[model samples]
Target: MDDDHDDFVGCDTWDEMTAWLGESLPDIPAGVTIDFGPKDLHIGDEPLDDEFDDTDPIEALCAQIVVLKHGRYLVRRSHVVMEATNYLDHDASSATPNLWFDDDPTGDCTAGSIYVDDAGLAAEICVTWLRAESGLPDPTEFGFDISEATHLPGLPGTDAGWSLDDFLRRLGH
Candidate 1:
């Protein structure tokens, strides 16, 4: 709802992107596991064998966010654990990424779009997340639909949601 987020689009570094996400989406809660793989020079991801490029400033980043109407793995009443990921072709290219969100940790991105800027992509992802948390569907105003995808086949995160550890261990970390 805040068009003021345009300034963040110019950010091209991991620190800057994370800082912007933190400040803008403060209500997203605290203590969620994060793979600062892109923030580093590619040391952490090699262990997990995750697919990402190290040539750019930020190749990949994911957040295990909380969702509504479903429970995480091994929990009946817990909120569903979902992940939002931003992947780029490479760092420093300024290519608009199509951020993905899904119910399962290893699930393919169920929702997203092709934006002209980075900050805008982040902003739209936040908006979609907030909307879904409130029981709303993906914002079609941005030009895409999560409902278009078939249900993902995968396991859940913890009651706390997907952890970087789960993703790692699954990848032979």
Candidate 2:
């Protein structure tokens, strides 16, 4: 409420974090599809809860979300902390693209998730995160632009705006 970073209460657990994000962000635009984290558990070095047996199937935190927009893919990843959302070029002819898992040296190998293709939705998601984190009700009031949002390795031209054409032109297609 104070607009201070220290005053903002970040999530302490994965469930809290993901659920907060899901509720805080706007619904994905029509034609957009999103995939959450894998059903399998990737607890890494963390100790398993006493309530479950070693054979029990634990659900992994919904940390990796992939949104496919305009045939391209944008990955929203969260490690110990949430990271900048990222994008990948459209490659396969299939409806769903294969998600690759990076083997963490520390051993947290959780696969990413997905959403349907739509650049505006992607940008909106980024802006929403920025607003939530910064405690800004109206992003523009603070002069926040999509460019200043959490889009990692960002889309090409700042002129194209948050559209399919922007991604296409940036990719040089």
Candidate 3:
């Protein structure tokens, strides 16, 4: 197993984040759908009607996660989807939908949110969340045993095993 901490962290802008995702994730297929709500804000599905009107911040954030995960990607891609919504009026945030790979308790993964005013802050928040949710030895630690998680097969950019198509397909049309 590679102990390299080569995992990219800390992005200063949405563009940078996207670029990072592109590099990190394997190639997405043509039929695959990435539903980012709105023309300019193409990250997730349609925003909730009362998202802006809602007083609570967490509620709005949760709503956005639903829309963002609509997009699909390969498992080995390691790509995460992010969206910008008017719900919080913040610069940016992130959300994950599926948390676990299998029935194994140790295989648990999380689909949550990280809100911040800037990319730098957002990256920090993501690291913190990863540390807290995974219960790893350290927050900075990467590459843990994901044997419980389903194995992803295939090459980058192609619709191979565990591709975005596979993920969305599992969700059902």
Please estimate how well model 2 matches the true structure, expressed as its whole-model Cα lDDT.
0.35
Per-residue lDDT over 1-173 for candidate 1, one digit per residue giving the tens place of the 0 to 100 score: 11211122334443444344444322221222222111222232344356545442332322222211111101001122223333221122342224322343434332322322333344444443434444423222221101111122695532434433333333232
| Model 1 misplacement above 4 A | 1-106, 113-116, 136-173
What's every prediction's RMSD, in angstroms?
19.5, 13.9, 17.6
Give the alpha carbon lDDT tens digit for every residue of 38-127 in model 2. Answer: 213234424646575555344432233343334444544322322223324433235454444354332332433334354444444444
Instruction: Give the TM-score of each candidate.
Output: 0.22, 0.26, 0.22
Please provide, for model 3 over 44-99, each residue's C-alpha lDDT reduced to its tens digit, 9 standing for 90 to 100: 22454445442422211111111112233212111122222122211112433233
Each model's C-alpha lDDT? 0.28, 0.35, 0.28
Q: How does candidate 1 score on lDDT?
A: 0.28
Instruction: Kindly state the number of residue pairs that clash in model 1.
Output: 2
* Candidates in descending TM-score order: 2, 1, 3
Candidate 1: which pairs clash?
Answer: 56-91, 57-91
- Each candidate's number of clashing pairs is 2, 9, 9
* Runs with alpha carbons beyond 4 Å of true place in candidate 3: 1-110, 139-173
